[model samples]
Target: MDHSIRLQIEEREAASLAPYATLSRETKGRFRPEEECPIRGAFQRDRDRIIHCKSFRRLKHKTQVFLAPTGDHYRTRLTHVLEVSQIARTISVALRLNGHLTEAIALGHDLGHTPFGHAGEAVLDELYPQGFRHYDQSLRVVNILEKKGEGLNLTVEVLDGIAKHSKGRREILPEDLSELPATMEGRVVRIADIIAYVNHDLDDAVRAGILSESQIPSHLQKLFGPTHSGRIGAMVHDLVVQTLKNGGEILAMTPNLLEGIAELRSFLYENVYETNRVHDDFIKAKKVLRELYEYFINKDDHWEKVIDYDETTPREQMVCDFIAGMTDRYALDLYTNIFLPKPWSVM
Candidate 1:
């Protein structure tokens, strides 16, 4: 059934696209298929592929704010991906965009992230002179990491958005604002990540008793609003409103909103991320990750077991895939068993 021609396909049509978990539109080029494009639903299949991949499963044990196993309430990468999906879909629906495609982009955005948060990413970047980035890793994850050694073969637009979603990259937008569904649907989710983390991390910080709402800088506190949900709503609403107001295109955040977000982020950095407990764990993760990288990179035999590619393949990517696939506990155990001195037994 062709989905492009329906005059606002009902909820059932959207739901029907769910079963074929790894198919894509036959559309050519890297462009997102318009409502008039050829072929069937591609976005839904991409979403399903990501949902079933090993990397997606590993997200459950990766950190969003706090370390894994700290407590149930703290957000893991899986939960974070779900939240971003929800938020992106909501915005997509309100604007009559391709919600499923937006959702696929959001769901797979974090697949390449390290076991710890930015700390782990920083360690890897330092270890590899050529550098490592989760965004590129995400593309590699979906396109080459899964599927019995084959990638999901997702749509080009989806891949482009995933690769360039980082703040430092160029913005996504249509050549003319007249186009519907817009080009930056992926970009929307990029900013949405910061929004999700800023508000949720604050909520977690308050819950963990590290900081209070009253302690938030007054200039930004009013924007923080009376409740966590309220603050997040305001942020999301502001972003959508701003983007739409710019003729349905995403714009760089205003200095004020950017500053406010930075302040809130700074608060999290000082009170939550930089605390001795969290930093200690992050350091341990770095040590483990570095050792694991070196071990696998140096020992061709071990690398062969975990990584299928040849030595001709880039060493950095081999190490990345090995580390990116690790569960938090698995990483820790590997590090302890390999690097730490073990007590002698009488056996």
Candidate 2:
């Protein structure tokens, strides 16, 4: 009887993966110990857990670039993560790294982003006395809030990837090892995330008519090419070629292409992200989240009706977690029910 399918995979990894690859059998282990699965490796289990989690399902309704976009094709937070998974896996396989770990990180990376995109995050940041960041909140979600507070019990490697994957307009790959993911797989997700967003956001901007294909800076258009797939292909090709050239000891990219990608990101911020057409709705989104935060934090009697609470946890923290977990339409619908006037007919 083949009782240990997992052992075969682990053995294959040792035989096939790059020397730098993080092996599933060598995981740092989960927060809580679990019985070894008969069939799957650690990272494989992690990927399955994230895909089935409630927060992962909520991503479909969460904002990406556009808040409550009326169009069907606009990228939602769900779509963004899927794209990142594809790009990261592609790079991981090319480098002979741990593709399972890469997929797990990519899928779970944005699980804690607030509804209504950054506008909602901004509201929570201001409203929470300790302040908020989606990356930190993501860790909090997996550790304390998921599975009705049992938490996900994910591997420490996956947890580290989720925590450190955020770039936030900073260096895409920081020089400080402290600022980078503990594994090369995590770093791949970081770069893939930016590549997914910068390219897709630009595509959405054009699709939304916020700008035209011609309005983009000519140098960027030439470098990335005119099509969406072409641009992502160009970016991924450069990264793979350069990283392999560096002996896989470090993830590397040519300075010229790196700077070119950076310029393309800057161009989007100037031409699409900040323009009145896009910025105006986010301003309104902030207001919705702000009102919701205030209503929950200040009105304790009413809050008890909605949030299941224990006296030990701070109310503000509970409220912040509750808000950040919401999907875009769910936030709006809740706000309307709580704050908007309902038509009344006297009987």
Best by lDDT: 2
Clashing pairs in 2: none
Candidate 2 per-residue lDDT, tens place, 80-139, comes to 999999999999999999998999999999999999988888888888999999999889
Candidate 2, residue 317: the lDDT equals 90
The TM-score of predicted model 2 comes to 0.97
- Name the regions of candidate 1 deviating beyond 4 angstroms: 1-40, 168-182, 251-258, 303-307, 341-347
Report, for all candidates in order, the number of backbone clashes.
0, 0
Candidate 1's TM-score: 0.81
Model 2 whole-model lDDT (C-alpha atoms)? 0.90
Please report, in order, the local distance difference test score of every candidate based on alpha carbons: 0.70, 0.90
User: Judged by TM-score, which candidate is best?
Assistant: 2
